[model samples]
Target: MTVETIGWNTAQRRGFGELIARSWSDAGLRLRYEREPAEVLAEYDIHLAAGTTAPALPPSPGELVVETFNAAEAVPPPPCMLSICFCLQPDVKR
Candidate 1:
């Protein structure tokens, strides 16, 4: 699992997830959002524990989280962010 973690740093962008999303997108990686990494990894983006779950699914065994106090939740939201996990499904393998 090529997991990447960006720790908390004032210089770092707020909202771990929001930054991750933008980074992934910039890398040309298609992603979706969910609350469970295990389940969402198979379909959408990474799962956020403190995040909301639409169609809930059991979280994965090992989870990676990037915590930050400067989250983009401040008014006027700083571009937003979220964690994303993904698994290459059979269809995608082809």
Candidate 2:
């Protein structure tokens, strides 16, 4: 898996959310959030899998796990912004 960090911004956040929704719809998977975005600098974790077509919701069990293992060495986002982790699958040859 590959990890990427997106800077917090109004436009970026909207675009990112839309992209995630589309991806989940196309993949027949549900998007699960770890928590609600109710803070000024809220952080959310979106977990996706390769099965089921139920409505998007929070993780239940045996779902994807997203973590910031190297958060100490990472740069924090600007204040009054949101941050999310996007885990992408590795490219493979047929």
List lDDT for all candidates, in order: 0.35, 0.35
Candidate 1 local lDDT, residue 65: 42
Q: lDDT (0-100) at residue 86 of candidate 1?
A: 31
Q: For each candidate, C-alpha RMSD in Å?
A: 15.3, 15.9
Regions of model 2 farther than 4 Å from truth: 1-5, 28-94
TM value for model 2 = 0.24
On TM-score, the candidate that comes out on top is 2
Please provide, for model 2 over 14-88, each residue's C-alpha lDDT reduced to its tens digit, 9 standing for 90 to 100. Answer: 434544533444443232222322211122233323342212332333333444344457577423222444433
Candidate 2 colliding pairs: none
lDDT of 1 by residue, 1-94 (tens): 1123322343222233333443343333223333333453333333434453333222432434434433356676444243443322224330
> Clash totals for all models, in order?
10, 0
